[model samples]
Target chain A: MNLKVENVSYRLGKKVLLDNVSLSLQERERVAIIGPNGSGKSTLLRLICGLNKPTQGEVLLAGRCVHRYPRRRLAQSLAFVQQKANTEDIVRAEEAVSLGRTPWIKPFEAWSEYHQGFVEKALLQVDMQDKRHQYWHTLSGGEQQRLHIARALAQNTPFIVMDEPTNHLDIKQQLGVLSLIHHIERTMLVAVHDLNHAMRFDRVIVLKDGGVVAQGAPETLITEALIKEVFEVESRVIKSMGFASNVQLIA
Target chain B: MLVKGLQGVMKSHPLLFVLVSTLTLSVFIVLGVAIGETQIDFQTVVYAVANGALGTQYPINAIDQGVVWNYRLTRTLVAACCGSALAITGLVLQSLLRNALADPYLLGISAGASTGAVLVTIAGIGAGALSMSFGALIGAILAFMFVVALAALASGRRMGNISTQVILAGIAGSQLFNALTAFVIAKSANAEQARGIMFWLLGNLSGARWQEVAMAVPVLLFGLMIVLWHSRALDAFLFGSDAAASIGIAVKRVQVVLIFSTAMMTAVMVSMVGAIGFVGLVIPHAARFLFGSSHLVLVPACAVIGAVFLIVCDIGSRTVIPGQVLPIGVVTALIGAPCFALVLIRGQRK
Candidate 1:
């Protein structure tokens, strides 16, 4: 499904958090939203997931306004994995992953075989199938992050939106999860603080002061001039062997 | 082999766990009805039960019939209902607010009910036999509405509410109603009347009758069924409201229905058995170990475990005094605190 954000804005009290942000994303497209801290990446993701309303303008999924569909219908087509998604209770790993089937399962019914298969496949994808019975609080932070992604995958939606998807992850876990995310074959809109990770996306949308500063294929848009202007950081773009650009931030 | 088999069965079928717990409760219930001031024998009690089942076809003597059928039967059954109602209500509130300390009385409904009871007992608004119950129900609903309205106000621009803010508002609401109750007790009543009010506030179940039991049982069962129907939604809610909504659960609508149902059940239980404490606060946590916080399993576990807990406590209240009946609330707190300490110790050891 195609997602179109049409000049949407959101205000919190006296402060405007999203200012006329608009974008059109194609099916199976991998787009990255990157910016400094508090640059409205999380807010925009919230609006896209229908968890928050736009102060003005609109969001359309498959050319229909997103607000028109009920929340369940919207969830069937899309899933959102939030940054710092946490539960303080002692939930088993498999139980947490199975929660993604909630939109499909009825209140009185148990999880069907197909739903169970989804949970199994999701855990397999994240390589956490062996630890499915472990309690969530007992898992390492990186393992928990991987489990959270598996939960999002278990939703079985065509599109997945993530905010700071690799937070609390070690480098190996980060690379592994990102590799898994790349091959999951879903339309993805991921917000990240890592400029290097953003550079690997098909498109990078750089945000500053609650508006899009630049957006395009990373090779074309992520210039040293643009980095200094948007990030307020002095940096050199290193040409790496397999990466589009390796950003080395400098003081 | 036997222990493993038992464990497997318990794990696979949650209903079997509920069945076993209910069997335990049934034993306590029998004891509750049989052992009174006069200490009726078990066979005699069984005969009375069978006679009642047969509509008194083989009638027992009138005095024994009155003791078993009228007094012990209603009060014991009512105590069980109170246990089931308050425990489930606490479980709902605890899950809804994501707070271990949240109980059925957190919404000020008990304090509201107390204020209403005070008005009837002292001011003579409706001085009939059942007016106290009626006034208490009205007060419970009113307090529920005020807490919800206040939560809505404090929740601010966020679509998903903050449970802590709602809880804080509830405490404020509770204090308001409690002060009103205290003022009425101080000014409008004599010393003897004040003493009775204190006993009522501390939850005495001596006035429980068949009429109150008839009203409470159906409401508790129906309310529990509705909660069971939405068990999956509540399980999703165990994480957080945002996570629940992300799974396409109607977070606000479900919260509203759950709050009202719990309040209604609490009102009915309180009208029959004053403001019984600790059963709601502690039983759900004890049941959580058996069922592991999934509402489908947890609800039934709470129902059975809470029933057994209350019936045992009621028996203690009766037997501790030779002829005098003890307040159910005092017994619940006095027994509950040490048990709660043990639960804490066990939890930490785990």
Candidate 2:
């Protein structure tokens, strides 16, 4: 199902965090929401996933308001990987990943092999199968991020939303994660700070001051003028052969 | 050797794991009934149980039967229920609040219950109309509400560090209620009344009749059911409430229902058995250590371990001084304090 965020605005006290922001994601499409700090990128994602109710307008999934759906049902359709979201450091990685199956499991039901298969597959996808028994605190920040992604994968939703998923990852791990994202057929809405990473997405939506400044195919939308206007930085969009355009920042 | 064997069972057969745990709990309960001022053999203890449960004559001595069936059995059963209830409450609180130090009493329930009990015993608030348990329950609920309100107030302005804010509010509320309890006793109680209240406050199971069992069992079962039903949601909270919500959990509703239900269960336990500390704080950690952090395993494991641990503590309380019985709370604290310190030290090392 396609995900829709329609004219959504979120306010905390007198400060408007998200201002009438609207966006949509087609099924199996990968989109990146890129913005400068304090541009309401995270807030927009939260609203879309029904983590926060929009003060104005509504988020619709498959023609129904997102918040109107039952939490478990909504969860089965959309999984979320949050930025800096952590639990008790003592939880084992495998146990943490298996929790993604919460929406599907019923009371008194045993954990079936089917659920275990998903968990194992997710772990393998993130190359975290070896560290599945490790305590969360024992893992590095990058490892933790991968485990978080594995959890969302194990959820096996049609749509997966993420906030700064590649934040703590190294260059190689970042590319690896992006590659994994590319291979996954699920619809993805990722909030990314790295313009280069945003360029790699199928489409990019640039947010500036809580509203979308530009959104389209990255080739057309992510240009020097858009970057200078939205990010207030001088950058050259270097087109490459059979690859996503790389953003080279002017020093 | 036994621990390893049990682990093997737990890994391979879940039904066997439950049966073994139940058997372990029964053995501890039987031991609790057998060892006391007057030593009763295991056979007599079993006979007393059979008579009580199966309505068999059993040909047991009258005094032995009376002591075993009426007094020791009820006390041990009540202790088991109280232990499991507190442990489950602690586990829930730790998960939902995302604080390692979170316990059943952290939200001021125990302190409030003590104040309520003191009010009834000293100030004559109900004037013989209300029982101490009822008063304690009232005080507990009121204290929990106060903590909730304080937490809400603190969280209203900023959406940052809610778990820490709630923990701070809990500390503040506990201090306030504890002070109130102290103030009431100092202001109103005479020498004998003060001593009686003190004894009760330190935890006494002398009053654990069948009625207490009837009260505690259902509450424990209900609370366990509520927790078990939402075990998946609890597991989802591994990464905090926001993460739980993103995964389709009704975070607010789940949090409210869980905290409220666990708090109520904790209050009931405290009202029945005073503030038996440590079991709530320690058992869940031990369970998590033995079994991983899955609530599916941890909940039942904590319940069983907590129940057995309390029964052992009760036995220690009964037999430690030879002729005199120590307060179960004092015994638990004595044992619990060291174990708690060990938990802290181990946590630091890890």
Question: Each model's C-alpha lDDT?
Answer: 0.84, 0.87
RMSD, model 2, all Cα superposed?
2.4
lDDT of 1 at A235: 93
Per residue, candidate 2 scores C-alpha lDDT tens digits across B71-97 of 999999999999999999999999888
Query: TM-score for each prediction?
Result: 0.96, 0.94
Model 2: DockQ against the native?
A: 0.73
Off by over 4 Å in 1: B1-11, B14-18, B127-130
Task: Please provide, for model 1 over A101-210, each residue's C-alpha lDDT reduced to its tens digit, 9 standing for 90 to 100.
Answer: 88888877865789989999999999998999787888987788888788889999988999988887889878877887788889999998788888778898988889
List TM-score (chain A only) for every prediction: 0.96, 0.96
What C-alpha lDDT does candidate 1 achieve relative to the native structure? 0.84
Instruction: Give model 1's DockQ, 2 decimals.
Output: 0.68
